[model samples]
Target: MTNFEEDISVYNFVSILGECFQNKASVNLVKHYPTGRMLAVKRFHLDKIWDNISIVQQEITLTKQLQHPNIITYYTSFVHGPEVFAVSPLQAFGSCKSLLDSHFNEGLPELAIILIFKDIIEAVNYLHKSGFIHRAIRASHILISASGKASLSGLHYACPLVINGRWQRAVHSFPLSTQPNLNWLSPELLEQNLKGYNEKSDIYSLGILCCELANGREPFADVDSTLMLVEKVRGCIPGLLDCTTLPSKCDDRECQGDCDIEISLSRRGFSQYLHEFCYMCLEREAKDRPSAAELLTHPVFTLVNKGISLPELLKPVLPLSDKVSPNKEMCHLDHVLHMSEMDMPSCDWDFPIS
Candidate 1:
């Protein structure tokens, strides 16, 4: 038997869960041989770490330092022959993006959205205060538990925003080119003219992510990444509203003849506080955007008070079913095929959420 299979024998490989592109990690659901506890294991093939060892190492280092309710718990990591592994609690609900794609294809209830966003912003704020910048803040990086509590994941792109207790303005090197999905990146990152992006870049992504949650798809879905970069550089912004938020009827059809009735109605339909908060995050100029801490106080978050309870929040969304059957090999192959067909990018600026 191959060393990979030999090492993995300690656990019953139930199924494949997901991937971590930067670290060359494939998350798998496995049952511990000893206690029979099920866990998600992110296996990183060391063969791919020739020179990029630091990138994978950074994820392990940063994750070990993080301890928060909304951040994924890093259980343990160990090298096993040709590969390395980082184990964490299984997120039965999967990522927000996957869940949205599968179940809530039209977008979630506003209360649910607010609850998820609140947890995310709070986690991000904690990270920033602890001197880290979760450069990636997309929907795919947000993992939901069976209880419906959201936690941030995908920390491979994370880096320190502060140095020696002071916030730094620029980074010395460019991010890896293999990283895909530049559509969610901020203008500062795409332009590459600015010294470098900082924490504010994440807020911009958060704004886009909010729109994604509302629309059930990525923004600029029809545009090419290169063209999207041009528009962002040219000061163009995406509309936050989608069909779900717009009104079905327009009373005044005459005066609204030239005006976009849906757009007008959507504007009025959105929660004023939430809309304004999202607008603040999408500010073109990085400095104009509010920091994570400042955003926590926005009316959208503050007014929610005690949001939906975890049990209630999880009820509408069922846990991801185990597709595994008697033929384990076929189940694994099926998962690989399913993942390959997804339009989700290989790497899109991951920031820590859980």
Candidate 2:
């Protein structure tokens, strides 16, 4: 039998109610025969033994460290033979990817898109505050819960903060044969210099996700992979193509240079606030890009809030019962908060690596 068939057989007696979603990394669904209530099962393929060890270890470690409602809860992890399995709260509505696919032919509701973005940003901020960086932040990683709440999943790419006071770069390099989602990569990552990627890269990816939401289609859908990479490296900006009620310019530029204002004016339009948020995220300069925490306070995000502070906005709606022990949470939170508050007493926000 195939790996999937073998894995399904083990959980087969549990009776899968339905297939909720499937992605490059996981298949999510609710099961019934094992119990009367709903449950989320994430089945990981162990046949590809190349990176399974590290991915599995990171998933368990990251899940244990994170505690937020916007993050999908990790109930338990089990090793059944060669396959690794994890159980969490199942979201009946599936993922943002599924929703976007269904509505691509038409269009997603602006409010729904805003709400989803808010949840994603809040989740990322929480992760950053907790001293973890989710290297992979995409539509498929977001789960729309049964109650319509968006939660982030897929911690396999997450990495803990290196305590050596060095800014470690991402080690997960994409192969040349596999075309990367250039629309989601920051210019720094796409550049030939091979400059290391950091949290700012995640922000760039988030900007692409926003574009997808606004246009109701994948960013650079028609562009071939090679041309997409070239444009990305050359700083080709993407604009909304679906809605005509917004503005033409993607964002305000202090200097228009030689570019024709008329051409800029003819581009697709989007909500001014949303466009600004996307532009800030897509900024070529990493330092200019807002941190996830700062983005939570931006006008685009704050405009949708009733009266929530950044910390409050970072809090998840779900209870922390599914999280690791309170003591562990406190330790992790304390360390992260302390690190965040640390200011270089001598170097003006710069730390010397030695």
Instruction: Tell me the spans in candidate 1 whose CA falls farther than 4 Å from its real position.
Output: 1-10, 22-24, 49-51, 163-166, 177-179, 243-269, 302-307, 310-316, 321-354
Cα-based lDDT for every prediction: 0.69, 0.56
> What count of clashes does model 1 give?
9
Q: Write model 2 residue lDDT over 47-139, tens digit each, in one string.
A: 644344565666666776778889886666677665566666656555566555543333344555677888889988887766666655666
TM-scores, one per candidate: 0.78, 0.67
Candidate 2 Cα errors over 4 Å, as ranges: 1-28, 32-35, 48-51, 104-106, 160-182, 192-194, 242-269, 302-354
lDDT tens per residue, model 1, 190-230: 77775777778888988888878866776787787788888
Question: How many residue pairs clash per model?
Answer: 9, 0
